[model samples]
Structures are given as C-alpha cells and as structure tokens.
Target: MDIIRIDDPRDPRVAAYLDIRERDLVGRHGRFVAEGKVVLDVLFSAGRFAVESVLVLENRLAGLESTLRKAAPALPVYVASGEIIDRIAGFHMHRGILAIGNRGAGQPAESLLATLPAGALVVVLVGIANHDNMGSIFRNAAAFGADAVLMDATCCDPLYRKAIRVSVGAALKVPFASFGDAGHITALLDRLGFGQFALSPRGETDIRDAQRTDRLALYLGTEGEGLPEALLSRLRTVRIAMAQGFDSLNVAAASAIALHHFSRGG
Candidate 1:
C-alpha cells in the first residue's frame, strides 16, 4: 500500500472523509463510511464492496499493520495525527480507524434471490427504518447463518456508518438486496419457490411449529406499526410464544429466536 501523510485536514485527497457526521446524513454520493478496526477487516475480506481508500490515526497504524496488509498494493493509506483526524472527521477519533467503501453497482433483488441454494434461510424486512434495529437484524441474520437479507424500499441503508458499526460489520458480510414494495416482493418470493412466513403477534402458527422448506423467507415489519393487516391476512403468519401480557419481541430478538429455530431445527 502507498503510505501518504495527511498533515492538513482540508487536503483535497481526503475530501471524501470531511465532515463525516454531517456528510453521513446527506449521503456520500456513491460512497459509504465504515468506522472501527472490525468493519475495516470485513471490508477487505467480505468482498461485498470495493474500498476507495483508508485513513488511520498515526499512533494506531502499527497495531493495524497486519490488517492493512490485505489491501491492494496500490491502495492509498493516509495517516494523520489524532487532532488532525478529529478535525477532518468533525468529531473525536476514539476508534482511530476509518475507510471509504464504494457502493459498486448493486445487484437486483430478483437476481440476488435467484442465486440462493435450496434450503436457504432468508430474512425479509418491511418499513424498518431504524438504524439500530437494522444493524441488530443484520447481526442476527449473520449469527444464525441466514443466506441473505431482503428488505422493501422503505428500509434504511445497511451501509450507513453507524448501522455498519452497530452491526459489528455483519452488514458487509451478508448478501442483501432491496425491493420496490411489499406486494412485488411477495410475488417474487412466491415465483421463486419460497414458502414465506410473516412474523407477528397475531400469527397463526407458533414459530416452533412452522416447518422449514427448501427455501424459506421470514418477513419482519417495523417496530411501531408492525406488519400491515393486508400482509398479515394474505400470508402464513407466525408468532413467538411469550409469557402472559407480552405479544412480541423486538424484531432483532424475535429474528434471533425464529432464525435459530429454522437453522437448528428446533
């Protein structure tokens, strides 16, 4: 890797990393920010996206020598002082690791879905815009070995810096694609030979009783509104049994329990 020293926060070479907290919200155009050492490891090994470049705090570079060695020789690695990095990122630099990952051209939802093997486990999300929930869901999906994650267009980006950080970088490891809407997704899942289940408090089958098929799609909804009545009415619904007065679990917890059941044949 080419080592470049960035002494000035306003250097054009690092424009992509400027005002990270603000730019993260407006968006980075085709790029996404990934923070922390763990996410940097995933960015290189997962092969889910191309890395643009890397910026490291001066003191932390030695500790990351092995990890940064995975980079292509031509990749630019910019090292800066902690104070300079803090100015560049517009925040404190406690983690001392950052990278710019290109989105690349995203694969279409149907194309991604078509590639799943028989007996694949998939998690489907609808209207889940909360970054924390999105991160936790990806973490659960990876933990349970779900083959992929699918979400409607209403969901948030898994690549958002905080979401990726919160996921402990699982968002980069898991293969995922977003669809236009719930109805289109339903049709696609059916046409693709998946037996789909909508998980909710009023589901008809207990998650334990729901049998896995050659391909399974587990649908989860937003935190507050939950799944729409129409979705619940048209699909096979499932519930996680809980003690009295509790009807549901946080989507992440529910996904863990439900995915564990399918993955381990509980």
Candidate 2:
C-alpha cells in the first residue's frame, strides 16, 4: 500500500476528514464518514458502500497494512500525525482511524426485500430515530442472523457515524432500506408473504407463545411511544413478558430478545 504522508491538516486530499462532527449534521452529498479499523473493514464488506479514502495516524499504519492492501488497495491511504488528524476531525478521536465511504444509490425497500430468500427473517423498525438505539438494533439483528432490516421514514440514518460505531460495523454488513412509513413497511412485508408481529407491552400474545413461520418479520418501535395504535391494530402483537411491574424494554434490548426468540425456530 502506498502511504501518502500529510503534514498539513488542511490538505485538500483529506478534505473529507475535516470538521467531521459538524459536517456530519450538514450532510455529505451521499458520502459518510466511517471511523476505526473495524468499521473500515466492515465498509469493505458492505458491497453497497465504496471506500473512497482512508486517513490513519502514522503509528497505526503498520498494523493496518494487510487490511489496507486487501480492502482499500486502490484507495489512497493518507497518513498523518495523531495531532493533525485530531485537529482535522475537530475532536480527540483516539481510535486513530478514519475512512470516507460512498453510500451509493441504495435499493428501495421493496427492491431490497424482493432480493431476500424465501425463508428470510427480517426486522421492521418504525420511528427509531435514536442513533444509539438504531445501532444496537442493527448489532442484535446481525448477531441473530436476520436477513435484512426494514426501516420506516422516521428512522434515523443507520450510516450516521455514531450509529455505525455503536453497531461495531454490523450496520455495514446487514442489508437495510428505509421506506415510506409504518403502514407502507407492513404492506410490503404482507405482499412479500411474511408473518408480521409487532411487539408491544399490551400485545395479544406472549413472545414465547407467538408462532414462528417460514418467513417472519418482527416489528419494533421507539421506546416511549412504541408502535402506533393504528399500525399495531393492523398486525399481530406479541410482548416479551417481563416482570409485572416492568412493562417495557428499551428498543435495542427488546430487539435482542425478540430476534433471538424468532430466529431460534423460524
């Protein structure tokens, strides 16, 4: 791998690495910043996102050689002092790793779902705007082997830097597509022949009692508001059945339990 040494933090080649914390909110015109070595590796495996460039602290370059050669061989790997990188990113990013990933024109929800196999297990997320919750759900989804994630329009960008970091790269590996709204997502799942189950504290059945089918899609909503009453009434509902006094689980925690249960048999 060719290493281009950078002394100035303001170099145009490393433009994408500038004031990342602030620019992250301004939008990247389809580009997303990925941090840490693990995330860079996952970005290579994502297939949908292209590795545009890499910026690594000088000391860590030796350890990342193989990964750079294997995954980002064609991309420029710019090396800089830890201090310079920190200045450029506008924070003390101790991980000493960063990469620019091009989030291409992702497939629409319907198209992405159509690509799944016949017995696919999927997660449907509605109004999960919290990046941390979104990330954790992706991690759980990947851990339990869900085929893909379907998100409603209100969901936050799973590619958001913090979310990707929190997922520890699962967000890159798992297939996901955002769509219209709760109603639209459920409609697509139905047309695709998935057995849909919306999780709610007042669910009609306990999670253990819910039957698993060949194609199952578990729906999880934001914590407080939970699933909308209109949407919940349209689908079958199942609850995790916690202690009597504790009626709810954070969306992420609930997802792990739900995914584990559904993934075990179906």
Candidate 3:
C-alpha cells in the first residue's frame, strides 16, 4: 500500500489531527475524529460518513494494510512514529489509529423517523450529556436491533471520539439525529403514531409486562433526575423491576434491559 511518511507532527497535511482533545472540545465543524483500529474499520465499511484522511503510528500501518485498502486509492494515509503522533495529538494514543470523517449535513430527525418500517424500535434520549452513557446507550441500541436513535439537543454528540470509541464503532453504524426539545420530540413521535414508553421507577407497569406496539419509542433520560414528571405522567410509563428500596441502574444498563425485553417482541 502506498503510504506518506510524516516525520514532522506540525506538517500542514496532518494539521487536522493536531491537539485532538482540544479540538473535540471546540467542535470539528462537520468533521469527527475516529480512533482505534475497530472504529477505523467501521469508518471505512459503514459508508455513513466520508473519510477525510487517516493518520497512523508507523508500526501500526502494516497491520492495517488491508483495512486501509478499502479507502479510495487517492486518499492520504499519513504514517508517523509514535513520538511524532503523540506530540500532535497532545496525548498518548495507545490504540495508535486515527482518522477524520466528515458527515456533511446530518439527516433531519423527522426525515429519519419517517422512514422506519412497521415494528420499528427507536430509542429516544433526553438530557444525557455524559459521553460514556451516550456511547453505552448506542451500543445497546445497536445490539438489540433498534431501528434508529433520536436524541434531544441536550444530549452530547455521539460522534465525539470517546463516545464513538466506547461504543465499539456502533456510533458509526446506528443512524441517529438530535432533534429539538423534549416536548417537540414527544409531539413528533405522537404524530408518527409511535407508542411512547417513558422509563421511570414511578412507572405504572413493569417493563416485562409492557406490550410492544408496531411502532415503539423508548424514552431514556439523564440519571438522577430521570424523565420529567410531566412526561412520565403523560406517556405510558414502564419500570424495570428492582429489589426493594434500591431502584437504580446506570442509564445505559437500564436501557439495555428495557431494550432487550422489547426487542424480543412478545
């Protein structure tokens, strides 16, 4: 495979890769950085996003020769020693694989929701700002056959490097879009004829006992505060039965159990 050797970290060709942690904070405009071999595999194979460029530690290139082959022949793949790569990234990259992906104009939530087939299962997230929780939720959504993930504006970007890495590349595979406020999302789901289920300890029915409709939207909110009382009371609320007094599960774990139960389609 043809490779470009980057001995200098500051070279203009590799500038997009510089100070990744800082860039992630300020946002990448329309671009996202994908790291690790697994994420790179998804970035190349998924076709959901356009790959801008690839930067790899020199020794890691041989192992990725086949994967890199999937890229357009003219695509630039920069190889650099570990030291140079570390200097550019502003942190140690143990996985030593990085690539920039551009998603362009993201699909509208309404457009994505309108395309689901009968028996669609989509996860709706609200006020979930933690990257790990966001990633875990997507991972579960992918694992359990969720058709799409719709998030409110309060949720963190799923394309963030840490979230994508935590999701084991599911972030790139599962289609997602951030919509407006909780009220707007709820109204749209209602308009789409989706049976909305808000998960909360105060829910009237146990999740195991909840019936899945042809179109179901499971709503998950941030930990501690959980879903809003107004929403919980209005929607068909369901709860994961827990032991006495202790009614807590990480939002991600809770989503898995709930998603798994409904995915079975009893």
Candidate 4:
C-alpha cells in the first residue's frame, strides 16, 4: 500500500480532507466523502466509483492493513494522529477513516431505461429532497432487488455523504440515474413499456391488491407535499393500508413496505 504520513493538518496534499463538515454542505463537484470501515469496504469493493485517496488515523491503520492491501494497492493512504485528523476535518471523526471518491459520469436516464431486463423492477422518485429518505429508498431498492433507481431532477444527491452512510453503502451497490420532472419520468417509463404506480395515502388501489406487471416502476414523492395531484392522477396509484387514526407513513417506512410488496409480485 502507498501509505503517506501526514502530521500537519494544513498540508496541501490533504486538501480534500479539510473542513469536511462545511464542504459536505457546499458539495464536492463529482467527488464524495466515504466514512467508516464498512462504508470504505463498499466504496472499494464496488469499483464503480474511483478512489481519489484515503485518510486514516495512525492507530486505526494496523487493523485495516489487509483490507487496504487487497482493496486499494495503488491508492494513497494518508495517516495522521487523531488530533490532527480532527483538526483537518474541523470535527471529531469517531470512525477514524474517511475516503475521497469520485463518481463516474452518470448514465443518462434514457440509456439506463433502455438496458433493463424484460421483467425489470424499478423505483422512481420525484421531489424527494431529504437525504435520509433518499438513502433509505436506495437501501430498500437494493434489499428488494430493484433493477435501478430513477430520480427526478429535484431529488437530493444520492451520493451525498450522509445519504451514502445511511444507506450502509447501498448507494454504491445499486444502479441509479437522475432525470427531468414527473411528466418526463412517466413518459420515458411509459414509452419503455413500464407499468408505473405512484404511491399516495389516497391512492385508488391498496398496495396488496395492485396487480404485478412484467416491467414495473414505483414512484415515491417527498414528504408533506407527497406527489403532485396532477402527476398522481396520470398514473396508477397504491396506498399502504394503515391504522384507523393515522392516514400516512414516513416516506422511508412507506418505501420499504412498497418495495417489499412489489418484490413479492403483488
């Protein structure tokens, strides 16, 4: 492994690791920060995203030696004291491991749709701006064996650090693409012969009763506003059966139920 020793927090070589809390908010162009050993394992194993480099606390390096040797031989592994790492990141990073990775050029939505199998199962999102919800949906998508996740332009970045961590690295495991608005997403899926269903509390069909289709797409919207009435009206709709008083579920929980139901060919 190409291990580089870094004592000074301000070293220019570690630019990507500096002030991460603020940088995460401002975005990192096409790059993302991966935290913790589990997340790093996924980032390295996926081989979909390219590793720029990794930062590790000196004490943590010994435990990760084998993983590093096999997973990232050519990559630079920078070691620092815990204090220095904390200073560099402007926060106490308890996990003691962070990796900088670059996202590959995104596949166009049309191209991704074109390559689906005959019995493809996909999750589509519109206006889902919450990072936690975005991550959970990807986790659910992966768990349920969805072919791909297609998100509208308004959705938050799935590659965002918190989202990636919350997903337990499903963001790396699953295939995804981002595209235009609800109309464009629906039109594309329609042209590709996908039966699309928008999930809503007031949906016409109970999720259990929704018929399975060979090629299916489930559209989930943001919390509070949910899917726009116009868009929901244009597609078949599904609702999870709920208790008497509560009319709705949290978006993430709803996604798990919806994805699970669809996976069972309901």
Question: Which pairs in model 1 have colliding backbones?
Answer: 119-214
lDDT of 3 by residue, 40-150 (tens): 887788778888889999889889988888777877899999999999999998878999999779888999988898889999988999999999998899889899999
Candidate 3 segments whose C-alpha is farther than 4 A from its true place:
264-266
lDDT of 1 by residue, 1-266 (tens): 98899999999999999999998789888999988888888778887888989999999989888878877778899999999999999999898899999998888788998889978888999998989989999988888889999888889999998899989899989999988877888888898888999999878998889998788889999767889998888789998888998665788888888888878442
Across 78-191, the per-residue lDDT of candidate 4 in tens digits comes to 999999999999999888999899887999888988888999999989888999999898888888889999988889999998999999888987889988767887887898
Give per-residue lDDT, candidate 4, residue 241.
88
lDDT: worst 10-residue window of model 2: 65-74
Task: Pick the winner on lDDT between candidates 1 and 3.
Answer: 3
lDDT for predicted candidate 4 compared with the true structure: 0.88
Q: After superposition, how far is residue 42 of candidate 3 from its true place, in Å?
A: 1.5
Model 2: how far is 9 from its true place, Å?
Answer: 0.8
Model 4, residue 65: C-alpha shift (Å): 3.4
Query: For model 1, what is the alpha-carbon lDDT of residue 35?
Result: 87
Could you estimate the TM-score for every candidate?
Answer: 0.96, 0.96, 0.95, 0.94
Alpha-carbon error at 84 in model 3, in Å? 0.9
After TM-score superposition, what is the CA distance of residue 194 in candidate 3 from its true location, in Å? 1.5
